[model samples]
Target: MHDSVWKFVCLRDLQVPAPCQVAFKWIKLYGSLADGSHSYKIRNNEKHIDWMRIGAFFFDSPVAILSEKLSLPLTILNKDNVEKALESSGACVLSNIKRGIWIADLQLVRCPVCELDTCEGTMQTLEVRNIELFLCDEYQKGSWDYELIGSYTINKSVDAASGGIFDLKHIKDRAMAGVFNLKSWAGKPSDMQPKAMITFHSVAIRTNLQENQGLITKYYAMRAGFEGEVVSIRISQQLA
Candidate 1:
């Protein structure tokens, strides 16, 4: 058995309302399972939540999106058919589409290379082990009401009495800026995808609470309809 099957699930239930004040925080987590860090100011909301891209990801150096579901969408996210138009414009391709936030083998990584069958130090050769049809946000023709919600912080409680999850005293007592992102871009022992959005979430877990708070809150807000209603978030984990 290994400890690599753990997953952090951030579920903002757009269909319901938050139960209490403690539960009504902008960012909330189930446990210390995700890396909620880094706050990203969203400029656009497409049919897909995308891989948390920045800069010229398409027209220039196609950066590899990190596979931290705690922060970025684990799979392809297409709420409508707006981002899909990128395919025709030669921006990207959405491969292995699925319902909701489910991706199919969409995790990208950086493979290294060397002339002597090895890579070392600053003289290393990094390679992007990408797919055939470079997946990107699609259906870019039908989305509106891109409102700006304030930053959300992933508030955690030290007192784990209620389902070992949340409490008020914890937030008031030991709440720091819980931001989850990458502890740098290098992946484990040998895989480096250079995905900046750790979503460890850096809108994610343990430390990434601040970042998680901001991004996930905006996502919840955008999906929950244009304000004026109770925005509810449901966070859980997956031991896959």
Candidate 2:
């Protein structure tokens, strides 16, 4: 097995310079169980979600914001993207995907892998399932504004699995995007909980596969920006 690959011999057969470019988003974790209560009182006690059964959230860094489902997007990449990622490593200089930094615009593909970090609880797995990514912007009450911008639906719904947790990032021209970094350990979970902390950071990415030279040409005409505009942006793991 190649050291660069994940040691999964199944990957030796993948075709390099595969087909297209795609992106992924993984959500498979909880933020806190403090929302629920276990103490039972005659009428005061009420049933809570299964997650509320846990003692407390355990982490050493500022926890990330979880989705409404009370889960964190852990991996977020397409299967094709992963395959392209493996292919790209052949001549890598500074990017090590397994270490979580990726080059922009990998390949066109769908399917996501999820990664988990510093967590505790009755661990469970679906063993088989499908993952997806959706783009959600601002929404107002009584207005339905949403779009399933991306997804990884497969003919065969199976486990989207990954081991351990690792920080991930995307880089281009030395600018970093899609970065996940945990805070320095204040101590062990057994010692004390994470303090409320904040880190100032910036995110930059190339949305269009094209150089977007059109914007420069239309700079004066579209200063207000194109209203009711629909753009399509594609990114993959092989892309850096």
Candidate 3:
């Protein structure tokens, strides 16, 4: 068992949807989720859909707007003429969309023994059951747009009966050894709630057998992101 780490980021309004309507958009313009064919391939091969949900500015430094070249180069093949190649090579275009800074809380859980041939093996996975966003007093007056742009679930193995026998004692020992830190990294109070809660179907952890211990640490680790819509919103008497 290991401790859970939390981080924070800022979210900007890329393209405002119609007032009071939520439009979920992909955080990255180019990804498996953006293409139907790629999504199908992932679902078929991996037995799960790999999609990332959240998108925001992750750095703490001041945001800067880099200058874009307005004129084309005279050379037929030059570094400046590689925009199309870059786009084709799966580069993301950072749009100059309306920007807003919203605090995002991230939680990461680490497991000690991710894989074992015996019943002692435990899967380390994080399932974001739901997300609640609590808007500030200013934004609480009127309805706002909420979108569930892109996300997916990965279920490695569902055959509970086929796995090794459940060991309650082993599980208890592991749980006791593990330290969970759900505290906010930004010094926010533990009781603080978000303005909205986004819920989705359960997404399980898909683990892969680690052959090269030198390269990977965990036995099973599925890297995915969560971006979803706000199905419901509740106003809190206390401000976040």
Candidate 4:
């Protein structure tokens, strides 16, 4: 399999909420590292929740809306049509795509170089190998809102007659935050051929339970809505 395939696999196993939190925290803490980490700040008062973080999760959401359901031809993802997407509601794409939290394992090693079929070169070659990896909240986007609501966290409890506590506990919690969706861009739909359709998988949710007094909250989801062709070219060193 290609390295990218394994990369997606590593990304798929990440647990939700925790991975989401880790991704959000990493971005908030390091997004400005290349420019200046200090330039970025976590907004939304400590008491309020952060919506930008919620938006980030929508970046590469696995969620998608079938074109058949939307009754529209598929849109494409290319340089030209992407602009049309910005103006039309034909398809929805994540905005401000940013790298999210990631975990990877890599190795550095030395190899041999050949000068001729039967001779060795005077220099050594170095190659890097990447393997066995996992990532959580690697990409996200979208906006969120804070609002008041009733929620509950399940817990094990004891049966009164049994005189023994259950292994779980059930608790109710509430809070508020704005909710947003992956929406079709606003304008006339474009006609750019796109490759394989995109959507989200291994879904999950993330939230600040402490503020909600221990409420179970879920992360909003977004899905793509477009149809077209996507082509990839690989330049080879040899003609086959």
The candidate 4 region of ten consecutive residues with least summed lDDT is 162-171
- Cα lDDT tens digits for candidate 1, 40-132: 112222211223222101111111112113222212232233234322322222122111221111111122122332422111111111111
Give a tens-digit lDDT track for model 4, residues 134-238.
111211121221212111232322111000000000000010001111133111223221111111211111111111112121111211212211110010010
Residue 226's C-alpha lDDT in candidate 2? 27
How far is 183's C-alpha from truth in model 3 (Å)? 28
Instruction: Give model 4's TM-score versus the native structure.
Output: 0.19
* Model 3's TM-score against the true structure: 0.19
lDDT of 3 at 54: 27
lDDT tens digits, residues 33-71, model 3? 223322113222322223233222211111211111111
Give the TM-score (vs. native) of candidate 1: 0.18
**Which candidate, 1 or 2, would have the higher TM-score against the true structure?**
1
Winner by lDDT between candidate 4 and candidate 1 = 1
Q: Number of clashes in every candidate structure?
A: 48, 18, 18, 48
TM-score of each predicted structure versus truth: 0.18, 0.18, 0.19, 0.19
Better of 2 and 4 by lDDT: 4
Q: Give the worst 10-residue stretch by lDDT in candidate 1.
A: 159-168
